[model samples]
Target: MTTTAHTPPAETPPAQAREQFRAGLRRPTSGYSPGYAQVNLIAVPQAQAFDMLLFAQRNPKSCPVLGVLEAGQYSSELLSGGDIRTDIPAYRVYRDGELVAEPDEVTDYWRADLVAFLIGCSFTFEAPMLEAGLPVAHIDQRVNVPMYVTGTDCAPAGSISGPLVVSMRPLPPDRIADAVRITSRYPGVHGAPIHIGNPEELGIRDINSPDFGDPVEIPEGWIPVFWACGVTPQAAVMQSAPELAISHAPGHMLVTDLPNDQLQVP
Candidate 1:
């Protein structure tokens, strides 16, 4: 007998929020998501939104926020068709520096006291970098970009505070300058490299092992370059442990109504 498998619609589902989130995460649409701007997500209590937005402004490099949602509203009028509660494929729920569960959907956890934040991710910036002939080791090797919780301190906002997180790329000496020039034009998505040579200076002890994502080959003639990452905010939210918090699973960004090219400063 041929058995039929059930599949859920792309829209947010009322039941099995965690399952829905997992379904969205099965694959990364990334460039293929088509016409949608990818976004980083952070869910926090309504009381913390003001302080968090202030933190984002103070640390633009690490927390380039794209949109903010008032308590109890999942739809983002600012991003146009952006739905905070269901747009993304996956979300991680944390309590006091510990990740308790990563639900596929968060509707059950949605609260009147919660505020949603859409921050910028480095994934969009990689599009231009690849177009410019810069090598993104992760994509080339079919691995994730290595993310590290650096010793660098973020500008604190009330109870939210943590070390800055960074994503690394190894580039040939010939391409480093071009990489800087292209990325600098898109400051909203992590602008440029924070470190170019030694990872130790940033308090990264091991180059091969990373706190998050997979490490790539550092071939001869190529030096490691690092950029501030959107994960910085999630880390802060996790550390704060404000009774409840949620964020997109790393790399599974919310596809938005905005265009990626618009991130560039004309």
Candidate 2:
């Protein structure tokens, strides 16, 4: 029941666009939905939601969950007045293991048997990282974090399996250990870097051209550090290809009611 904005506005203020996007379900969400928790969105048929939710629980570092909606329900009441069907800016539609479409809204594909999921994203942890004087490359470059399909395997669920996907950030070798420690405290948002160096070991052939997102420049004194990304679910969904699936498009994220500070494990 929501209208989609396929073409991003050329001159709208970031805050206004973010609000409009929050009103629909857009990922890679821009501007700070100030004070709101931005989440990764995933939707599957009723039959798979359970297994997917379990997969998320099993892989908490990669899929830290904030909430899940019941089948046929669009509202993520637990996370707030978020309407899963429309709050995200864009969504990927899947069929039989292939990406069929990326739409601004999924109202047309709405199904009575669908369930929605809202998982935590690194955006929450980046706030602390910046505050701690650590730099986030993607933020500095104004682009989505570069992600790659790694050689690491995820703990699998029924018919759902794939290599772990990681988002890369360049860090000074000296600050590497601290970045790991600081991010580890927020396990709910991909707590720490999985691999700190050598993209080749992760099956990534070219660091300049990542599998997803634009590459950021790696300067003289920095090393490429990677974190488990929220996009893993989308990749898994595409690979598994259950009938009639929907997910937030890369970068567009679900804005939730939880505070970013709450993601930290005391």
Candidate 3:
């Protein structure tokens, strides 16, 4: 999936990608629809909506809110012409906080009382990273990025709370600053590196064994850069043991109509 500086790969349009997913194509979305925004999905019952919203408000780094769909809603400006329940590549369903199923489409499991939250995803910034001549290891290796649940705890909100989760990318020492500057522009998309260097400092015991997503090769001399992940809410749902929750499987995302640059700051 590596692309040249000026000539990026042929990107699939946002609507077409959604159509493919709607037709049941399953895969991680890191490089899909390269220039459009991609978001993490977390849907919960109406009763738990406020707690989830408060949780996101308290943990903005990991769960920056992009858009929200009220109870019984399955579409919005972010996902025009698509159904939230079935447009993603894959979904994880949780009952009482336990992951009960991983399905291609959740029409059978989706509830009318659910409220869906679209949170920013790091994938939204990967194209910029690649365009900047920085290597994105997971895309380079054709695997999903590695993610770990750090020992650090997020500030609790109402009944929702959990440890912070982070996605990692290994980069050369010389390029770290460029990667940071390129990514920092898009704060709505979990902007910037939260921690750089040793994973142990973030309480990650084994860099090779990630709690979520597939691990990619870490070339020698390349250091790991960690970014707060949208998966944080899923972690909260599991720890708090909510009665019902639906989320995109780790690495799988909802590609949206919005352009990536739309989230960038000056």
Candidate 4:
């Protein structure tokens, strides 16, 4: 269910990964398929689809649009034969911005008027970070990445407005520059570190406690590095309270056929 990538796990194809998720395997998807891209999911009703798209455009750092499925559509070229309703590790169902249920599969909650947005996730760059000898704390500790709801407000769009959320990984002082360099190359996936040393500057009072996912251990002298999170859209969903919304459970991502290298820049 969890992996420490000191010795990387055998690669699993995106189709095979989706089959496992469809069959009810539920866990954080990091380090599962080393080279393939992973995406965060947020699906809302057809009526508010334009507003949601606008919200993403306004907050590109946290909501980089990867590939979107049409209103009522469930499958896309991203996952190659995967169904959006069942291919993720878990789902969160929200009604008017209230979290009502979290289930392994969301086929029962699927709506014909729903439009799904697949946003790029920072997990897309984790493999590259590891390859560069920069340790990923959550993966090593075998836990979901810690995410904090910061005091900084995101640029609002219509009814969708919320606080900025960030994912954290502790890195040694020496490797901080390398981590920044590696992630900056993949701008589509949350990009580089937004806040490097002080969590207080980001309005995060405590580093140990996170609003979402599990808290990771930060070794002495290792600073917490923050990245714009895909979960930020879910934060907006909670605050804005749309009629109906569905999203991936934090840390549970949808593995896609797209390779990680395709997103890297020279």
lDDT by residue (113-152, candidate 3, tens digit) is 9999999999988888988889998888878788999999
Q: Which stretches of candidate 2 lie over 4 Å from their true place?
A: 1-18, 22-27
- Per-residue error for 243 in candidate 4, Å, reads 0.8
* 9-74: candidate 2 lDDT, tens digit per residue: 244433454468756434455335544467888888888887798888888878887787788677
Better of 1 and 2 by TM-score: 2
Alpha-carbon local distance difference test for all models: 0.74, 0.75, 0.90, 0.90
lDDT of 4 by residue, 1-266 (tens): 23222333478888998999899988888787889999999998878888889989999889999999988788988988789999998899999999999898998998999999999999999989988989999888878889999999999988789999999999999999999999999989999999999999999888888888888889999999999999999999999998999999998899999999999987
Error of 1 at 43 (Å): 1.3
Question: Which window of 10 residues has the lowest lDDT sum in candidate 4?
Answer: 1-10
Candidate 3, residue 10: the lDDT equals: 62
Native RMSD of candidate 3 (Å): 3.6
Cα lDDT for residue 237, candidate 1: 77
Position 28, candidate 2: lDDT: 52
Off by over 4 Å in 1: 1-25, 34-36, 77-82
lDDT of 4 at 172: 99
Candidate 2 global lDDT: 0.75
Ranking by TM-score: 4, 3, 2, 1
Q: Could you give candidate 1's per-residue lDDT for residues 225-255 as a string of tens digits?
A: 9999888988897677677788877766666
Clashes of 4: 0
